[model samples]
Target: MNVIPYNYSPEAIRLGILHIGVGNFHRAHQQFYINRLLEDSDQQHWGVCGVCLLPSDKNVVENLRSQNLEYTLTVCGRHGGDEVYQIGSLRELIWGVEQPEMVIQKIAEDTIKIITLTITEGGYNINKETNEFDFEDEKIKHDLHYKDQPITVFGFLAAGLRKRRAGNCSGITILSCDNLQHNGDTAKKAFISFIQAQDKDLAEWAEAHVTFPNSMVDRITPATTAENIAKLNELSGANDKAPVHCEDFCQWVIEDHFIGGRPALERVGVAFTADVTTYENMKLSLLNASHTLLSYPAFLKGYRKVDEAMRDDDICRYIRDFMDIDISPYVPPPAGIDLEKYKQTLLERFANRSISDQVSRLCADGISKFPVYIVPNLAKMIKDRKDLTRLAFLIAAYRHYLKYQLDEQGQAYDILEPAKSVEDEQLIESDSAADFLNLSAFKSLNLKTAETFVPVYLNFVNAIKDKGISETLKLLTA
Candidate 1:
């Protein structure tokens, strides 16, 4: 039960990467890669400086700092074994709320070549309907007015890049590790827009010197609960507080477009390519969209974990059919990727018991997820005149889950969503599927008017209303 030792001295590591949003996924995926890279070579300069923006992240910063910015990463394999490694890739942890000036200074440092982000899907603040930066957002407005004391990630990035420009530090790459489509491009747009509103000169400087490389990052790092921490401590025989546990499977496809030199990430299983769109599309459509498709139905049926839902034959079949019949047609096989095997692999990943990914995690932020994961394929299916009954059922399930915040066992849960308009709530309450489809959430595709979509969606909605989610799923799979 001894923990794996670190290769390099923690004091010797240099911070070349400044990572925003020091969440579980960032620790497990990106930092894990840096740890691997550091172990193999003299890449001590590529160490990460973790940055936590929100006040809620204060505890994480304190935990990492108390541990000398070192923690155990327990990687669980599907074959029923765990590998524990003490990750020292994080050289320092910065709490942005406590020291905003230090966060800016860190970004402006010449040694910091790349800045990565794992801010959740909503962190971009793109209007779901417009797919553009929501300048009218109160946070954006506040960040613009009070640039010196910023709160959001956008403000931090803008202020940091401005400092870098003033210092004449070399250009740097902003790598987005979020799951959104064209994530790098999205970050570019959002950051540039934020800067433009604050200072036209900084925006121009960012446009010239800053590079946002889109990346497709994959890993199932669940939120670390106290139970997980206890188990990790027991397994690793260490009293680490912020240990991260994730499935052993990991993949990072990044665009090789860094302005400043990047780590030898390719040496440690990172895929650097000219284009990451195909890979991004494949993962988002098959894996992410399937997560969304299964989550609401599974949760409504009282299944709390993804693997538990995957064990149900009806739910499994529905997801398989949804992928093969509806989504696969839209997702072209990426180079060197076999679509069928990839789809099967996705099923296995979802079924990985070691990860124990929560259904609620997948269910959170559906409003943001749908546009990136579900909508584009859905739009294509409608355009191709294909049967969307299964997809329609997914939408129906999502609506039902939202309207009734109670699961099948009568346990009530809060729906974590942005403020819903009265009209949106009325639509959810309305029995008409068409009314629900007309929601601005679905306005991107005008899904309500898709001739074949409306009737099937309405039928499923009515059936779910009459029968429960479990019964409806059984009928659909049968």
Candidate 2:
């Protein structure tokens, strides 16, 4: 009945921060930074109380509970790798259904100074039409009226904020560590919209008291696999709840805008900057964009692992050309970053075969992923009348990719559309690919001017049908 792991301490209940979506990325990147802070200050004040947003998250919740919420991080690098078993940063793990009230109570607690979210990009529930809170969503409506039944991340955050505000918990910070552009601003906008729709007085109170810090987080902790578990047991001699294995590379750039207390994470390679927009855009456009490039077409070609995709000369070259030709020009490097060096490092990280990040996982939610990661670079290229040949092919590849086609290997696949709607589906299937480009989400791209996109897309579909992914990649490069 000893659920606790060897050498793992009992869960430390601290009133510092609430982290939603305690996935591998959060544990490896964010919690690792917190662990560094703990090392220096000996302060358990910043310890995290982890929360899962969905009921399906019981797998992670039960795993954590079984291990007494203990885990290890295997930091893999080119030269060598090491394990940090049970680093002891996280304090408590609470599932949404089991303890929704408990989550709100913690957020309401005066000692809980900050909240961090890594709830993935899709978790935000952003409306494509307005790029704001999807107020019309049935769940949002339910949460607005009934405080007891929480469904959306924004709903839980709003409820918690409402409670926090009622308790005069001002000076609290909300940090968003998702792969979103100006993520903190988006979080703030979501909260503000919710409050205004429900109660203007509360909106003003949040605006006056709350601070949302924009942040850029980079570390590839792919979904844990059985192989990963076996490796962790072999290497670390510890069985983790959700053991995180990542490339040695990790970076967190945050805007210095916390209202409550924040850790001095800068001591551990986290950059606190005046403007994090450039850093965010650089990562999203370069790394995330390159990821999509490999994820879609490569996955279609029967590549499951990230390194497998990267190993394909054709796929790796396409990804490289995407960064070199399209993304880099638009990426204005933030202070203290070298763009060339960063790009080289990203490629190396992508080529790391040990992690085995799934292309299907990356390919999921492309409807949301591309607009932020790839489309922006293409838009900039279109405006300047630049060589969108590669960019066009990327879009074309995506169009062909969405049809849920299988490879010669008989592997099943499906693309995650922004919304499961006929109109949304038409974004990829339309005869006029340009018209589809006018989808509410991508209208900002001003695709009407890009005369070459439709024809290029049409040709791309033809190439895939006639020539296949490998051959089409060659043609695009040529």
Candidate 3:
């Protein structure tokens, strides 16, 4: 297989976008698009400066720096051969954990027109109930006192914006390229709230200058395993340390309210819309929510690979019914979208063996995920007095997975719940089936008060424990 390297000069490209999280999703999606855009001489200044905020980012950052920030991206399709590309859009790198001052300075630089983020859903430090910044956070408190030497992303944003104010630099856009629904607005609420608590003047400056545009991004990017790296190096014939692989499909719909201008992204298949509400709701409710719906039960049933999970007739049927019967009514089709076809395409994408998205990736961070992906639609369903057996079963399975730490086959597995607090552990571990409903993920729905929802949920919870997950799912799907 021939590896198609970027056509343009890498050194000539300068940084215009300071992307906060240099993760696989960013590499596979946004950076891939920018790499394409950089092929044109006029877009040379639009290259990305990847910022690493966490200590976990050290290895990837070191690898990219070794290669002068150039890496490979393998695009796997549902039914076609892989297209290998040596992407060069990531022109610079900065690890904020090591150099917090530099992170602030770069954001203050007028040359950097936009600050894009791939910080996962829970990274916002939002109080789930209030949907605002959690000021009581110790790190946030530290940032408030020591604004100049910042640590958190919000701290970096505030300090940087303040520096920009002092330097009289033009305002920049803060676009969230994450999976969170209404992500831009959420970001605005968090940043503004934090900045307001720390400095009134800086908060006002950001309020006037900053624009957070809502965006809907799609791509099935799996975590690159050691086997993937070995195979990628074999196929591309490159000793690339920071190589990334994702499904061929990618979509980024922006609210088109960019400050200090934006790249000609539309020319590169990016959609610019006055409103991203419909797209956000549709994608969140259908793809993201369905991913959550299937993850626990599928994992509990001992399926790790999404493709393998989808191969099961009952699993596929469950997901299909979820999209059509549970979610379709609320998700109005965005322009040019055939809802039914999109749902079919999603199934096909999930079933793509080449990509093989991990069921565990879907299973990770369910504490944060449930609130974002599942609860909204679940709340609506409860309000409408609709059939919620599937949703209830998902909760039951999640409880079983978390509390037991064992699959239906009695195989012990590690669960990844990044947002799991001590209190969350207590609730999940509580013997009472009804106590799990009070988990922060479902707090907004107030499931205890949900007359139609609780009885069914508790039934599944009790039945799954008594009869086992396999038998219970067989009954649910029947």
Candidate 4:
């Protein structure tokens, strides 16, 4: 394997971007672009400062700091070739758990112009139904009281901005690289709302200074398992403890609304556009929604890996139908993209055996995912009175995956839904399928009152429980 070493020296680079939630996706996506930029001697000032906040990030924090903030990123090509690169752009690692003040201080520095985030959908702490910041969150309330010493993402950001305001520092753009529609606008809403609740003056300042550029990010990055790390190390001929891997396919389309100076990301494949909504809609509706459509049923059918699930004839056919028939008619093709080719590419990306993306990862956050990905098109389909069997089947499978962790083969699997609220938990536990309609994930639509959709959903729910996932999938797809 040929490992592409970054030509720039990490020590000589300056920290210009502070990225929160330094996970596999971030390592492969934004960091990958910045790694390329660092090769240009002029762009060395744009080195990344990775921030790890959650307790689960402790291992990554320790591993990265020990490795001098350098790691190998194996870009696994879908066509049986792989390219490895030594990523050295993350010059610094700060865990807010220990160095809370330091995290804030770094953000306050005018040198850090862009604060990129991969905090996941739930990480924003938005009330999905209302499309509002969750003010009642315990962390938000606590952070509001102790503003100086912050813990939550919002707390740290607000506190950092406040201190930055005091110093009359230059404006900074909070770029959200998450998979949410209108991510920058969403970030602005959540962060600004949180700031307004705490300090009106800072909120006013942020309104004028801080810019949130919406972006659409794409890449099939899986959770790096122990086996992945070991294999990557062997293939790269180096003992890299914090190795990350992803498919060769990568894209980022950003809204050109940076108040402060922005990186020359356009020089790389990163698309800087006036509006990212078209790209955002195309991705969320087709790629993300299709993932949700396939995940639960695949998981219930005893499939752990996404590539393996894609191999199943019925599963692949169902996903293609969902994308082409169910949602494609509603989604407008983005300016330069060929919708048919894009759909085919998405199918190919999902079936890439080299990456081996996990079904469990796709099944992780149904609570936050459904409202954004499936709800809009679902509502449209309901109004138009289209065939509701596919989406209805997905909801039934989702409920089963949440309520009972057992698969069709009688093997049990762990469910990861970090976004489930108290109400969601209660509804999931209810014996009646009707109660699931009240879930926050389905709050956008009155699933119970959708006369055409409800009965079909109920029938599928009954069918899934009685006949198991595989049989129900066959009948539904047939």
Candidate with best lDDT: 4
* Candidate 2 lDDT by residue in tens digits, 309-425: 777888877877778877777888977789989888887888786666888788888777766787667767777878776766766666667654676356776655555456766
lDDT of 4: 0.92
Clashing residue pairs in candidate 2, if any? none
- For 338-374, candidate 3 gives per-residue lDDT tens digits of 9999999999999998888899999999999999999
RMSD of each: 1.4, 3.0, 1.0, 1.0
- What is the TM-score (0 to 1) of candidate 3? 0.99
Clashes of each: 0, 0, 0, 0
Q: In model 1, which runs have C-alpha deviations exceeding 4 angstroms?
A: 419-423
Give TM per candidate: 0.97, 0.93, 0.99, 0.98
Ranking by lDDT: 4, 3, 1, 2
Clashes of 4: 0
lDDT of 3: 0.91
Q: What does candidate 1's lDDT look like per residue over 267-375, in tens digits?
A: 9899999999999999999999999999999999999889999999999999999988888778888789999999998899899998899999999978778888999
In order, candidate lDDTs are: 0.88, 0.76, 0.91, 0.92
Clashes of 3: 0
Residue 194, candidate 2: alpha-carbon lDDT: 79
- Candidate 1, clashing residue pairs? none
Select the stronger candidate by TM-score from 1 and 4. Answer: 4
lDDT of 4 by residue, 191-301 (tens): 999999999999999999999999999998999999999999999998888999999999999999988898898888899889898899999999999999989999999
